[model samples]
Structures are given as C-alpha cells and as structure tokens.
Target: MDDIVKQALAKWPNVPHCTGWLLLDRRGNWRMRDEAAQAAGAPGEPIRHTALLGFINRNYEADDAGQWFFQNGPQRVYVELGYTPFVVRLAANDPSGQLTLTDQADAAFEPSAVYLDDEGGILFTNRSTPARVAVLHDHDLDLFSEHADLASDGRGGEFRWRDGAVLKLEPVRKSEVEKRFAFVASPAAYAATNPDNASR
Candidate 1:
C-alpha cells in the first residue's frame, strides 16, 4: 500500500468501496467502465495514463474474501477480472535465458506450481500465504510450447526452464479455475449474491 493511501484511510475511514467501475482485462490492461458501458455489458476503455497505472498498481490488493481492489486514496475500487487476478508475461532483457515471469504490475513472479488448462491456457501460482495465480500472456504461448514436452493426450507435460529446472504441468479445467483458486471473477456479481459483502 502507498503511504498517501494509508494516510487517506486513517483520515477518512469507512469511505464506501465502489465496484463495477474498473476492470483488468485478460491481456493485462486496466480499463475504466462507465455506467453506459456497464449497462451494455461491454469492456470499458483501456486506461493508458502511465502515472495513473503506476498508482493503481502500487495500491492493488485483495481482501480476505478474495476480492481484488485498488486502494484509491480513501475509497476501495474493486476490479472485475477478465481472467485471473494477475496476467504475467515474459520479462524483457533477461540475460540468463530463463523465461522469467512478471505480473501485469511488473513485479517478479516465481511459480511454485504450474498448470495447463483445458483450453491450453498456462497458469502459474506463487508461494504466497494465500497463493497468487497468474495466466501467461497468449503471445508467449509459442515460446513456452518450444520448452515443454507435452503428453500424447495433451493433458500433462514437463517444462524445462532455461535455468535447468523441470516443472511438472498438471491438467485443469477452465470452468473450475475460480473455485480451485479461491478468487471471485466478478466482484459486483458476487456482492449481489452475497448481500452482506456489498458496500452501500
């Protein structure tokens, strides 16, 4: 959390949280959804301001309920996820040739486990207390395929990292990702069903 955001929370505690206004797309873009867009069920405009993006990334966090949000000074702006909470991509200029992964926030991610979804989506999970999951960027799939030894059934595989670490890839169904990872895909929809979790 940012110091300014912490001060704002201390100064004005209980500022109601807002949802259905921001989104994190599968491609790692932050989008701002307006009332019109929300009503039409459309993905909002992509947020391109560099400084604003940094601020949001700095304060992004998840609640005990597994709903991710950006601490916008005083109010919490919950993010609607298009996929997993984090979208990772291969880090640039990694001299070691090891396929380093960095989350959308541009932070280093060390996977404790990896999975291949039914649709060929690659998922990585870190060893954090609650565990954080990320989806590899689609553009990097070809590069990853070159390093993986997949099974005949395409259900399991072994990935050889440039650093000489071999990881066993497990199979997972796309529809079970949310429950398996303990994350809410749509916070607004979740709050609607669990009225007690909603902020008025």
Candidate 2:
C-alpha cells in the first residue's frame, strides 16, 4: 500500500457507506479496483477482488459524487467516490482536496472548474461570461424528489436521468465541412494581407 492510501486508511478507519471508490492516475487511468468492500469489518465474507474501476462502474450506483486528485512529485493519486459525497477530512500530507456534488436539480448540466460552497452549491466565477449554473432551491428534498434513473439502450449507449426525465446524451462530433475555416487569422497577418483596411 502507498503512503497516501495508508494515511487515508488510518484517518478514516471505517470508510463511509458509499456506492463505490475509484483510484486513478494523473492521466485518468484506473489505478485500483472499483469496489465498495467492507472496511475490514461490517458484513459477511470479504469479496476479494481486483480491477477497482471495473467493479465500481459495474456494480454500484452514484448520484452525488466527489473526487480528490493528489499530486506530489512523480506520484499522482486520484480518489473518487460514487453515490454520496465524501466528507473531506484534511490530513497533514494532503496538499489539496476537491469535492463535487451533483443532484437532480443539476443533473442536466456539466460541472465547472470552481470551488464549491460549504453546502455543496456551485460557486460562480469572478469574470462574467455566458455560462449556465444550476442552483439548488430546495436542498433537503431536491435529490430525493428528482432522482435520475439509469437505463441501457438496445445498443451500447447508456441513458442518464435528469429532472425526472431520461435524457440520452449521445456523443456527436462535428463534420469536417463544419470544422473548416474554424481558426481565426492573427491581427498582424490580417493587416499584412489587407494593409488598406481601416479596422486594424
């Protein structure tokens, strides 16, 4: 076991009842098995397994989740939890820890790279721009009332639940014709090409 994992184990002797836990590398590669095993206690025979990523993705379910990606020198450790948002307990070696919570109110949107509030609300950026933010009006019963359901399509694609509705997010890429002339010419180049143009 690594020093960080050991430290986490020591601090949280009894891991909270969560759907799944994932350990990933800096390159987003799965490092450990994705399973919610008993923390050396609590249930029947321990399910000894490997490939943590596969286990969690296959077995458990999650709605509001959090992930902590730690970097120290060459070692990169990523800890992710599915189902319930983890209660962050700061340790001595912890440089930075991140937590994210997504529920029924915010299921249709994508998360931004911003610090979350103490109550798990998404924080806003100082620089104003056209962006979407999902605010939880009723924190107590929002998630329970607007639970998302997971459904598998006849094909390999999976459907995600949003706002008490099943929404399919099929990956679609722009065509090559649509992607042409996408790069904007530099101002200097444009001026050189059109010297007489007044809009310099």
Q: Which is the leading candidate under TM-score?
A: 1
TM-scores of the candidates in the order shown: 0.96, 0.17
Q: In terms of TM-score, how similar is model 1 to the real structure?
A: 0.96
lDDT of 1 by residue, 54-126 (tens): 9999999998888999999999999999999999996435575657889998899888888999998999998
lDDT of each structure? 0.91, 0.28
Worst 10 residues of 1 by lDDT: 90-99
Off by over 4 Å in 2: 1-68, 80-200
Candidate 2, residue 28: how far the Cα is off, in Å? 19
Model 2, C-alpha of 156: deviation from truth (Å): 18
Question: What is residue 169's positional error in candidate 1, in angstroms?
Answer: 0.8
Q: Candidate 1: misplaced stretches above 4 Å?
A: 91-95
Candidate 2 lDDT tens digits, 75-189: 2233332211211111112343222233321232333322223333322111223332222223322432233222243222322232333333222222221122121112223
